[model samples]
Target chain A: MIRRRFPWLSYLVVVTGAVLTVVPFLDMVMTSFKGAGEAGTLPYHFLPKAFDLSNYRAAIDQLDLPVLFRNSVVATAVITGSVLFTSSLAGYALAKLRFPGRNLIFRLVLSTMMFPPFLFFIPHFLILVHWPLAGGNDLFGRGGAGLTVSIAALAMPFLVNGFGIFLMRQFMVSIPDEVLEAARIDGAGEFAVWWRIVVPQTRPVLLTLGLLTFVQAWNEYIWALLISTANPDVMTLPVGIQFLQDYVDPTRTMPIVMAGLVLSILPVLILFLLLQKYYIRGVMLSGLK
Target chain B: MVNALTPTTTERAAPSTRSSSPAVDGRARSRRRQAVVAYLFLAPTLLFFAVFLILPLGFALLLSMSRWAGFDLGGIQPVGTDNFAGLFADGSTFLAPILTNTLLFALGTVVLALAGSVVVATCIDNLRFQGLWRTLYFLPIVTTVVAVGNVWKYMYEPGGLVNGVLNALGLGSMAFLQDPDTALPSVVVVQAWASVGSAVLILTAGLKSIPESYYEAAALDGAGPLTVFWKITLPLLRPSLLLVCITQFISGLQSFALITVMTKGGPGDATNVAALEMYRQAFSYGRWGPASAAAFVLFVVVLVVTLAQLWIFRRKEEDA
Candidate 1:
């Protein structure tokens, strides 16, 4: 009733805020349709003169969209699958199984989340560069470009997520112990019990963790940029588009960059929209993006 | 299946029963096996931590103290405290512009996003299609930083939408990201804009948790909407406000991806922050020692704030 009293004001504020929120995306879409010299011109126009589709063609052709797409998809899939599998398995173990030093391991996992990720960029890159025997390095991890040249570099540092394991463990802790105990008593091994019973029971949290990891890995840029810069052969969608923007002329290529961005963002946008409930819950659980 | 399982299971059982202590021995053996299985399941994750988490940390610390030019571990020259000293030494931009810029950027984002989210979220709680509004707001959050940064960068250009709006209003267009004075704030605005969605979500959740009866009681007392918000909403929303505040502050402190995409920390380092500086030091300049030291300095700032937040929240929990 209190909120109802100023309904007009509320409507005005909410509508205004929503428009402000959506306008950049709308502008990006509109700019992608602008013809050459039409964007970044004397007067900015909200809409294109005509709905041109040529920029998408240029983006695909010039930016090597296929290779970028392949790299992005492979990296995202590997990171997501690895995170989900590892999180679920480790979660089950930490939650249900008896083990020595379990407390210490759990604390270690929690502390891992506390360390800011920026601290790792320098060392992680160096570690990959010195990875022995991969990329022509020696036994001591020296004297070559190392693993940075390979596609696995895109997924390496992201594969094991501490937060994912923590989320899975928290969710699994709620599952009644008797279900696992029953499976175990029925001659089921720990692996089979986790695979059949725990995994299915914890499917919702897994989906949440999976979607979170998928979105993050898909949109990840810095490490991908670093890795792609080290070896151009492993460029992902974001890295490729950014590289093009950095090197090419902005005026002639702005629309194409916009087109590439539109294409690059569509997968995550669609995925988030379809499974937004899970994604939103995951955000809330994590408390920040 | 029975025939296949019979031999191995009997073999496993026979060893425990040989001393006529079947129950105790069997339980102990199974517990040990479970422990082994648990560790086996955890092997990959632990190995990853050993390499990525633990090793990187030790290496980062070591590198912070030693000068090395991008290659060969054997070339590291030990120079104790020099890297840290250089950051704060005379004629160093690290103390004045870089670290100060980082703090100001984080503080500005938290303030702007918090104010905006409070107003928008409180209003949206009473509106229909809340999910749609939330989803719309969350687009930037789901978006790659490259897209958000570039879009905002273009919009801040001379002939772009933001300036276009300014000219339409009979105002001169200003260079947002190019000017030293405006560059940091320009990026801060984008950061706040991109983050407001999640803040709104958290605050709205907080608003929902407040009992509707409080509003009803206020309405009966002839309280104005402003009075109701001030008296009831603000007090009850403190926890969520603090949550958004500290989390956003932490994220703001560490985030350099957007900055990298937008300005790459310059029109002469005008927009440079600690993390970006650290990144450039290593990646661009190949000064591994100084870069690692910058990272540790930034880490100490982040750690202090994080610990303060934890302590504050814990104290609040205890009081509650």
Candidate 2:
């Protein structure tokens, strides 16, 4: 039926949608180069009257891009590593392992999904203040902000993901038990079986989880804002861009802000381009389950 | 009784064989070993959850019950249920309106995005450049929220492209992000645009799973396209629709960054959803109690809605 009439409608819709989506991005890039006067002018210039790199230059000079980028990278890497390793292991165990309290634990994990994250902010902040760790004081750890102002605080909260575990478990459950038994018969230990046999088998899932964790961690703003506010040195890109907006003069800042936004998002865009297939698959898999 | 007799006879005959063989013992030992390995594999995850998720959730519940400004150690006081009281007490002034707006925004976006995605997906499903369309639509989802927010902020400026286009089309420029009436809806449009790709993908997958035989059968029965879609497509696509609706609901409720960047709940607390409101109260107003209360309220609403949806989905699955 679709093949008969209105075949051109499909092409028109696809082209129109594609143009609508990409035009904003193109506008962003063009606006990043336009002066403030030219930016707010009428009729919306598709191409900049004068191509200027000053906005990019000024943004780099004004904002702590390198430090923020490093912080973002470190935090995202740690959180991704921890989530992938832990979720995969937990997922495998939930899928294949038989234990006394396995079902109970799995159920508990599932139930945690009901708890909204906003509910934890107040308590988590208080706990961070009194956390007994490296920066913790002698009693109740009240002197210094224990986990409050560090990159560790930024990364620590998201290390254990219930969704990640659930996703991995669903994927792992489809794997045959015979493979594990064969590995066991060959005298491979549990860790060996998981590392050599199971881990290799779940590569696609791991990639999906890794890309997701990276994007999420990189884009995290609220927690980063809360924990890293005291330390200007450790701000991530999102928080940095936010603060940059406040510091820059609005009349002259539009271009720089746009430039900073472009800079901030480049990594994510590149990451998406490289791993979009895995990302889409992961979303479908996790969303379906 | 027959099974028991057979098993006993077989066991008696195989006793010598079983006793002589190491494979059975090996199997038992391997099982024990596997159990040990399973625990080993679970250790890191369990430990992380214990310290991070479990402990923090426990602490969050405790904090909700107490009155702490979150900064000072000397002012920690246990004021049980007071925070929750403040949530409802303040509901009349700002919380009620914000909650209504948020829920309304969520519903609007979900419905709009669902409709948009279905149409776009159906159209794209038969297109030649499937990959190109998918990439273009999905681009917004991949873009960082801050970047997208900033771009949209530009687009929403008084003389920007949106207003420019509006004016060009013979309609006067509307106060998209400035006016209270249009701000929330403007944000909704952006959110819908950002989310439609994923919804399309999920619905497309659902559509693909429907056997072509049904369509063939429908066509042979002289059913119109709209009839087939309504009768055949909608019913089989219920699961995906439900998933998209619930996920988009949760996402729309928790939304903050875009609003923060675009409007900052602007023009007199117009776009202040609970999450953004909580941030403002806590960081801007230093009203720890009120913010915590707001957070708890938001949490409850989301939890209840999500659970209700889950229950509905489960019931539907069972019926199927």
Candidate 3:
């Protein structure tokens, strides 16, 4: 009844907010089609004169969209795959397996989340550059460009997410011990029980974690930017697009950058739309994005 | 999420199979093997934490104390307290503009997003198609900061939509990011806009947890909508509100991605924040020692703010 009293007002507020939320994206899409000089000029039209698709073509050609796409895909896949596998494995151990120092390790995993990510940026970059032996670095981690030139740099710092492990562990705790014990009694090893029982049952959390990790990895900018700057060959979409933005003439190439961005975010947008339930659940579980 | 934010009760209370342990030979052998297997499962994660988490932290501390160029570990010259002192030294922008902007940026974001999300969340609690509305709000959250930052940057440009709208309304067009006075706040608005969706999600969940009878009772007592929100909803939603507040505040303090994409802390360092400064110091300027110092300072700020936030929240609950 209280809600019923202000129905129109509520709709007005929500719709207004929705328009505010969606307008920037609509502008981005429209601007992607705007012919050169038509955008970033006097009057700042909301719609393009014609929905020309040349910007997308230019974005692909100049920005090397395919290389960027492959790098993003590889990095996202590696990060997501690593996060899932390691999270599930560690989560199983923490949740079900009997062990010494289990409490310490679990607490360590929890404490990892306490450290803000920015603190690690400098050291992570340094260590990777000096990472013993890879990228022509010696055992003492001296000499070449290090792993920063490789695709692995895009995914390394993110491979083992503390939150992912914590999430998986929390969910795995819910799986009845009876199922696990029965499996063990049936002579199943701990690894087999984890693979056969815990993982299959925890599919929902996995999907949630996977989607979260995938989007995060795909959208990761600062690390990718750092690494990409070192070796442009490994540049991800965000970095490549930004590089183009940084180097190009904004008035002439704004549409191209917009087109690149639209293409860059498309995979993630579609994935999030399709699996949004799991993604939202992950955010709900994790609290902050 | 509220539960997850808290130390998990299940960690201590649930899923431990150790209660059935006995001295039987099979059990003893299995226990040994189980420990081995558990360690095996945990090895990769432990190794990663050791290398990435623990080692990096230790290395960061070292770098904060030593002066070194980008390359060569041996090039590090030990200079104790110099880096830390330099940040606060005379004529250092680190103290005045950078750290101050960081705090202001973070504070502004928390306030704006909190206000917006609360209003929208409360309204959405009464609406149909709540999921659809939430999904719309959450688009920015799923989008990369590049897209969010660049779009807003262009919009704030002289020839962009924001100024376009202003000119259409018979008002003057202004340079948003270029003006020193308006630059920080301009980026802050984008940060708040991008982050509001998740805060709404948390607050909506908070709103759902309130029993319907309370609102029903308020209605019977002739309380108006505003009074209902102020008296009943606000008090009931405090936990979730506080949850949103703390989480957003922590994130806001460290979030420089949007700033990087939009302003690059430019126009005479008007929009520079601590994290971005730290990033530029290390990567852009090759000042690793002072960069790490800035990072340590920033990390301590985050810690202090988080603790202070918790204390303030605790005091509020007590006062209530």
Best by lDDT: 1
Best-to-worst DockQ order = 1, 3, 2
lDDT of 3 by residue, B158-257 (tens): 8999999999999999889999999999999999999999999999999999999998999999999999988999998988888888888889889999
Model number with the top TM-score: 1
Candidate 1 lDDT: 0.92
- Top DockQ hit: 1
TM-score for chain B considered on its own, for each of the candidates:
0.95, 0.86, 0.90
Candidate 1 lDDT for residue A54: 96
Off by over 4 Å in 2: A2-4, B1-36, B70-74, B90-94
Classified by CAPRI criteria, candidate 3 counts as: medium
User: Between which residue pairs do clashes occur in model 1?
Assistant: none
How many Å off is the CA of A64 in candidate 1?
A: 0.6
Off by over 4 Å in 1: B1-12, B15-20
DockQ of each: 0.61, 0.48, 0.58
Report the C-alpha displacement of residue A145, candidate 3, in angstroms. Answer: 1.5
Question: Could you give the fnat of all candidates in order?
Answer: 0.75, 0.56, 0.75
What is the DockQ score, from 0 to 1, of model 2? 0.48
